[model samples]
Target: MSSILHVELAAEPAAAGRSRRVTGRWLTSLCGAEQPCATAQDLVLAVNEAVSNSAEHAYRGDPSGVVVLHGTADGPRVELEVSDHGRWRDPPADNGFRGRGLDMIEAVAEDVRVERGPRGTTVTFCGTLGQCSGTCEP
Candidate 1:
């Protein structure tokens, strides 16, 4: 069986937290567990980073921009995509504490893909629950 969730909201700093909360809830229900396990928790963190990046860099000076988060859980596999309609912006030079979102996402997710075009930017993250040591089971 498969389960899916979609969320669309203004591209603001708050969107990241909202996406995390919604994704966490959806994952828990989809996994049929009281709460997501360690691997699933890592996936939620990746989802937060993706939405946070879009909220911070995608819109630049435009507060009217929006972000879309879509996720699916199929068997032991999970996939999430976060997209924005604004142009993509390269991460700024590190100040010692910044520019680590993409790196963190790549570290936690089993597979990651990013696409950018005139229409928008989309980041996809995929991971398998079974990759963890029996933590995903309810």
Candidate 2:
């Protein structure tokens, strides 16, 4: 079985929390009664990092910008894409306190891809559902 979800929100710091909540609910529904806590945590963390990066760096703290999140659950795996419409910016200096979002995302997600172009940056991540190793038929 397959399930999908999409969401778009203002590129504001506050939107990050809202995005996490929405995504978590959707994931729970798609995963059915399996309750894959670890997978859910990883997916939420990855999505939050991607969204936060757009709100903080892409728009440079401009809440007027926008962030788009797309999710797909195919069989035993789930994929998520988070995109922004603003230009991409380099991470902060090593000594900076907030340059580790990408690193944290990479650590949690099974696969991570980042693309940047004139229009903006997009992050795509995927991982297998904890309770559905071969298929997510429920």
Error of 1 at 46 (Å): 0.5
Clashing pairs in 1: none
How many backbone clashes does every candidate have?
0, 0
Local accuracy of candidate 1 as per-residue lDDT tens digits, 31-55: 6667677778888999999898889
**How many clashes show up in model 2?**
0
| Tens digit per residue, CA lDDT, model 2, 14-70 | 879988998887776666644536677678999999998888778876658999999
Question: For residue 62, what is the lDDT in candidate 1?
Answer: 92
> Residue 98 in model 1: shift from native, Å?
0.5
The candidate maximizing TM-score is: 1
* lDDT of model 1, residue 129: 69
